[model samples]
Target: MAYHRRYSRPGTNRTPTCDKISEILGSADKLAGEYSFGGRADTLPPTPGLFVNGVGMILLPLVSEHAKKLIAKCRQSRDRPNMDMGKSWLQSDQVEMKNPSWQAGMEKLMKNIARGTGYMDIHFTACLTN
Candidate 1:
């Protein structure tokens, strides 16, 4: 079976764990030839060594490891390999964000909250509630 893990702080879930995300991405990398995967979350397809039908998301314990890499991949043109990864994320609704600045701000806040101690529940308030 495919590994489905969530990397978050010991008792908090604000930022995404990038390292863990990277590991997951690496694992998923093993599966890049089996399934016709496509999207930001679809980093790698199931291959001979990788498992099939195994997919997951990273959004806790730490910032998403692939966050930067994914973003970089997203920014890449379609000519590049895996360049469409970002597009898949958007098509899959995994990234339901329209504004880049807004998303960046939210990511920054999540990182800060994850690092420090504060009631930073983004869902509770409409705006910054720290």
Candidate 2:
């Protein structure tokens, strides 16, 4: 069985639940939110289990979104960063430090997606990021 979770969400990881969640996820089989294993907070299937076979298929939506000009341009920082509590903003480095669980989940997701697309020649590399 496999489990998947996304870390990049608003107000997510505000509390340091990563360690505890990792512990529980490692040992517990009857988990509450194991997505790949079919556990979900919502009863509905998380995804329709559609099989996507190519990298182009995955990139189409992202390219379409970008072409639509949906993404906002970032303002320049001059010793002033946006600090609205309701807003989520960070650089790549900050995201790695502040939202490690999300980063790990993203890495796992990318690996899975690559494998699913049949375009990946994966070699498992063991290393420590932190």
Candidate 3:
């Protein structure tokens, strides 16, 4: 299973950055909303045998949507200083930072995208499995 999320500080971080998250969330929400997951929201104790690959393939559209959003969010704070957030957004993670100009929050956003893409690819493949 794969899940992806994006974050944006509309005013504190940067306009471009927040705009990117909005763009990605828009695409992902659209795809996720339109694509049926083949299970009800309250479907508990999922039947193990209900492994129809076709059902999983439904999330591919959303994966791409997520990646796009991730990249956009990562690139957003490339020009802002860490002080923009009034606190150090820096993190201990290496990939947590993308470009020099990217704020700490943006770095984390990039990492999220990288991680999300890997999951998306794996799930997408699982969906294609026959």
What number of clashing residue pairs does each candidate have, in the order they appear? Answer: 21, 0, 2
TM-scores of all candidate predictions against the true structure: 0.18, 0.24, 0.20
Instruction: Mark the regions of model 1 whose C-alpha exceeds 4 Å error after superposition.
Output: 1-95, 118-130
Task: Select the stronger candidate by lDDT from 1 and 3.
Answer: 1
lDDT by residue for model 3 over 27-64, one digit each (tens)?
76434432322323222222222211212211223467
In the range 3-100, model 1's lDDT, one tens digit per residue, is: 55545568766454666775676676344333332334322222212111212343433356645544543333345547534443322333332334
Tens-place lDDT per residue, model 2, 1-130, is 4233424358765345765565566544443323343223332223322222221112323566443332232223434455553222223221112233534554665565445444356643333221
On the 0 to 100 scale, the lDDT of residue 76 in model 3 is 24
Off by over 4 Å in 3: 1-13, 33-36, 39-130
For each candidate, the alpha-carbon lDDT, in order, equals: 0.41, 0.38, 0.37
Order of quality (TM-score): 2, 3, 1
lDDT of 2: 0.38
